[model samples]
Target: MTSTPSLPDPAGAGQPIVLPANGTTVAAEDLQARFVHAADANADMTIDASQVENVGQAMLQLLVAARAHAQAEGLHFAINAPSEAFLARVAACRLGEPLGLEMEKEREQ
Candidate 1:
């Protein structure tokens, strides 16, 4: 199943921004738009990365930017239910710290 980004609403305030299984450049636009929508609404951003199997640099960069944007806006940004592949790709790119991925473990506790 292809993941689609969801806009935050009162009824879905904590809904996550779901990432497509193939996190390549093709999905970057949709991802960015999702981030923009969340930022525009001054909402906290949560990413659902469980579907991500193969993520490319473009998608990774967008994620980093999204985190920075959320931080600058004083909003929380987190990834939930990340898949092993997603974690490994972020680690392979040495972006675990930047993406606040290690914090996921902390949050689970």
Candidate 2:
């Protein structure tokens, strides 16, 4: 069975971009594009990664860059309900801080 990927809604502030289940390098470009579009449209953004089953360094880098860009623009960027796989990859890559993820809570979740 095939599942449709959840696409981000580029509308108002605090809009959430739900990450795909496979968060590897293959999805980095698309994810980056969506993240940019959402962040630009909204002053505050939430990225829901609860379905992520895999993660790659490239994806992590994109997220870090997006967070940095948002901060520079004085916008709020938050990762909501990150999956265990996503959290593990972030911890392995030491990108928790750059991505503004609360590691302790992430582990607990």
Top model number, lDDT: 1
Which candidate leads the pack in TM-score? 1
Q: 1-109 in candidate 2: lDDT tens per residue?
A: 9999955565233557778888778789877777777766755667888999998778888888888888988887889999888888887777788999878754543
The TM-score obtained by model 2 is 0.77
Model 2: per-residue Cα lDDT at residue 33: 72
TM of each candidate vs. truth? 0.80, 0.77
Candidate-wise lDDT, in order: 0.82, 0.78
Native-structure RMSD, model 2: 7.4
Expressed as tens digits, the lDDT of each residue in 1-109 for candidate 1 is: 9999954472146778888999989899867777777778888888899999999999999999989988888988898899988987887777887888884543333
Whole-model lDDT for model 1 versus the true structure?
A: 0.82
Tell me each candidate's RMSD, in Å, in order.
7.7, 7.4
